[model samples]
Target chain A: EADIYQTPRYLVIGTGKKITLECSQTMGHDKMYWYQQDPGMELHLIHYSYGVNSTEKGDLSSESTVSRIRTEHFPLTLESARPSHTSQYLCASSGTRSSNYGYTFGSGTRLTVV
Target chain B: AQTVTQSQPEMSVQEAETVTLSCTYDTSESDYYLFWYKQPPSRQMILVIRQEAYKQQNATENRFSVNFQKAAKSFSLKISDSQLGDAAMYFCALRQGAQKLVFGQGTRLTINP
Candidate 1:
């Protein structure tokens, strides 16, 4: 069983449509991250949150936006989806600095824009 | 800034044999952690092993072990008696204190029957 869950395991939308990718963790981790990965490639961090109401853009620049209203929930939204937005989005959560479990990742969401 | 690098894009090993995947990272921080994660076709990222930067002893788990050289900034994963199930895309990640995790370009491992 997965402690972290991402809804809409797969999504396809028309260009210019707005979509929200939902990620929730049951572990109550203080750190949550959203990573964008292309097929057969590396993961690029697009957004991250240290705690509630604290979100920051990652090393990779993305048009998407994220929010951390609660400790367990971090959702990424694209105001206008485009063909370039097609890729897999992975959600991960981790404990505090002292915790050594690393990051627990969700199965990931495959997004396609037509 | 932190960066992880996996030199090999793909590696193949015969069943029951051993294979090693190489990873190197660049980081200025002394207090950090390293991890190896495996992602199968299902796309679920599974934690394979972890190593703390301060630990001198290498970390091992069952058929998997990591050669963590803090001085060299290299962390390699060695899989003993490789099984068909072991075939997957393996990623090397690094995380500094209270910082986001950095991932390398994954290496696809193939287990030959």
Candidate 2:
């Protein structure tokens, strides 16, 4: 079935290490988003892309950046990861007419920066 | 700007019983959409139900249903026949036009057997 996927479900790294979280969706949706969520807390949008080559920062300030190189792929990168950057990263995609169905989300990547 | 709120941080219900999760939002736009998403432990978040602001009728999916009071800026989820699988984090979300979706603090639902 067509669904969104996130790689490296759990990751632990030393502080200052550079890393990239992979996100891909096979649903051919035009809108993709990245959200940061602390355990048992509300999710906050960090980045979003309307389509290929289009990206924008979200409401919450984030040190990470994202790029939409392809319709199905939206990856987030951190130049130097910090303990504060550690959290669950969720990827979601929505179709052009998403009012009816809303968004489809990936399992999420839990990163731990020590 | 829009804001979504889930007053209840957590809720509990007995198996095979019914429970309601409250949600309220503030938006100036008349035309918009409301949705309830469920995130199970270590699992992906999935849309449980959606409601269009213009639709007067409530939205329902199987044992999941929504009580939408557009005028009052309220949208609540009602789960019937609660199951163990229903125990999860439930989030209320809102989207207006091309704006980004806003999410409320999730309510963790616990189903007691």
* lDDT string, candidate 1, A4-102, tens digits: 999889999999999999999998799999999987768998999989999999978999999999998999999999999999999999888435768
Error of 2 at A81 (Å): 1.1
> For this target, which candidate reaches the highest TM-score against the unseen true structure?
2
Q: Mind giving the per-residue lDDT tens digits that candidate 2 earns over A27-101? A: 999999999999776899999999999999998999999999899999999999999998999999988876457
Model 2 misses residue B33 by how many Å? Answer: 0.7
Over 4 Å off, model 1: none
Error of 2 at B27 (Å): 0.8
Give the interface RMSD of candidate 1. Answer: 1.3
Listed in order, each prediction's TM-score against the native is 0.95, 0.97
**lDDT (Cα atoms) of all candidates against the true structure:** 0.93, 0.94
Candidate 2 CAPRI-style tier: medium
Candidate 1's DockQ: 0.74
DockQ of 2: 0.77
